[model samples]
Target: MQKIRYWVVGGEYTSTDFETLIEGTERVVGPFESRSDAERTWRYLSEDHRPQAQVRFTIAQEPQGTMTA
Candidate 1:
């Protein structure tokens, strides 16, 4: 199974605002079927929110599994 992590960067925004942004941006990086989904999600989140603040994706892979850190 693959896991995707989507997050926002920069100034803190309410969950509602972030959700709205994600809704619009998800398509840009999503519809993935593997671990690469995380990359797409991150790109979408970062690209959309980076301009407002500093943001980055921290991906960690484990021997048995992988997760976003």
Candidate 2:
């Protein structure tokens, strides 16, 4: 079975979603299985890396071997 992957990131943006490389942020946990897993990790990490006023956590998903953005 093909495994889907989720990635977490943080940044400020006017309009964008599922971007591989967001302008102000880098991939935090890279790709893992499931959005829930990624969100859990993001929540834990956000404690130390709190997002600023314009920044927010984001999760992007992709199926293995398929382009997501």
**What lDDT score belongs to each candidate, Candidate 1 first?**
0.43, 0.66
What's model 2's lDDT at 67? 50
* Candidate 1 weakest lDDT stretch, 10 residues: 22-31
Name the TM-score of candidate 1. 0.36
Tens-digit lDDT track of model 1 for 1-69: 645434322333335344333332223232344557556666666676666642333333333345434
Provide the lDDT at 26 for model 1: 28
Q: Candidate 1: which stretches are off by over 4 Å?
A: 1-33, 62-69
Per-residue lDDT tens digits of candidate 2, residues 1-69? Answer: 577888886655444443444465654677877778898888876665554444467677874689545
Local distance difference test, candidate 1: 0.43
lDDT of 1 at 34: 55
Winning candidate number (TM-score): 2
